[model samples]
Target: MSVRLRQATLGDLPLICRLRVQRTAWLAARGSDQWTVAGKGRPIEIFAGEVGRALDAGETWVAEVDGEPAGTITVNRRSDPGLWSPWELAESVVVHFMIVDLRFAGREVGRHLLDHADRLAERADRAWVRLDAWTTNSDLHDYYRRAGFQLARIAGPGAHGPSRALFQRRVVPAHPARTAPSRYSLQGYSGGNSAM
Candidate 1:
């Protein structure tokens, strides 16, 4: 099956909530009890709160595979209060939260969502795309690395009850439309820069 990414709408809130619940359960199963720390209540309530706000503000995306909601993401332009890095938060776009059903874990849906979000960020003239994952989940940290994000730094054990490490990938400025090619365009330059 193939997964596709699309802008999220208000109607998607319900499915997004369900996905968050599954994600919380899955995370807890892996010994990351952070989700349960907030109480045994449904984690979707909190996820829905964030997703709803993002959707209303027009900053959400969803990934679907064969007509099923496989994953969801909320990309915001604002930094969480007191949680912003002086360097990374200067950008216009940030990934606040993202999750995929365990059933769709290895299908590359998350990478597709990231690619879509990157395009959206570039279109908005954003300088970077950033996110935070639990520091204890090395496996998830490696997953983000594989998705082309470089580690930024660790933030405190916030209300989420887990130490989180921020990650970021810088977005280069997009070239403007031109009828004639510029002289500096495609000149002799090696691709060995560390920027990649």
Candidate 2:
């Protein structure tokens, strides 16, 4: 079983874009250039243009928890033309515009989303699940590294590029998979350790 990844519809635009806005604000508060208005993120016009194209290509999917939108991801078969070499584009599925709602920050929703992406890659016979992360965000880099990706290279010398740090991991969602515990099992204990 995998997290439900549904094809996004026109009606889902508000939820999707809202999550992006939330993530943009979250990153800014952390002093990260991951997605700010100063060109780390695309201009609104370009962002909407990419969304339209991805929707047309049927590459956008939303992970909904309990019938409510929780996050969005775009797994494109082609890499961004300016960021990756043509050879890299052919071998892997490129993950773009991933945004998880701030409320789901520590719930492993993003991991589950990536698991869904892994299944997509597996079915497509792709060798890897790849993404371009923001270059200066070492914290974000470490996050992906913990999720099993390896750094390939820092792709650009300047700040004005579309996610310059490339990372990849083989589509190996380890079986018995790293999953959240049954919520029922934690009923007796608060998140904090009382004994401590």
Candidate 3:
């Protein structure tokens, strides 16, 4: 299957939220508390608020497979407070809120979304793509590792959230001869030729 990514809009809020709920339930079924609160899934309002900010900042993207929403990812320069040092944040793009639809599981949609993040980092002149995975999810950690991300560190006690398993992958040029600027044709936005 081919995966196409486009900038996420406010109209996609429901789809993103539904993806979160669906993934949460899937995780619960596997006995993982990654996105759960007291054995219950996180409130949709809180998740929506977090994603809303990313959407507003134009840092979120939705991946589609065969014209159907299959996954979502958010990549930005901002790191969650205390997750990374200022120097680390300055040189990297932070990935957040990545969720792949259960129906598309094992289809490599997550890999394509992450490849997009790597491209975004290269376009933005960043050195690395960094992310903090759910601390308790060893499977997720292994997933990132298999995706070429190295485990940086587990956040210390000072870190404030369950997403403390830090990981990063260095950005490398896919084609060294291609020096042209990257273009993104985002719907509901301008500057289609600019870097995303």
After superposition, which runs of candidate 2 have C-alpha atoms over 4 Å from their true positions?
A: 1-3, 158-162, 173-196
Candidate 3 global CA lDDT score: 0.80
lDDT of 1 by residue, 31-88 (tens): 7653454533325576578678778776777889997888887776655544556565
Q: Model 1 scores what on Cα lDDT?
A: 0.64
Candidate 1's TM-score: 0.77
Error of 2 at 9 (Å): 1.4
Residue-level lDDT tens digits of model 3 in 1-196: 8799999999999999898888887877888876777643346798899889888878899999999999999888776677899999778778888999989999999998898888887777778989988877888888999999999998898876678889999987676676786774212323210000
> Each candidate's lDDT (Cα)?
0.64, 0.68, 0.80
Model 2 lDDT-worst window of ten: 187-196
TM-score of each model, in listed order: 0.77, 0.81, 0.90
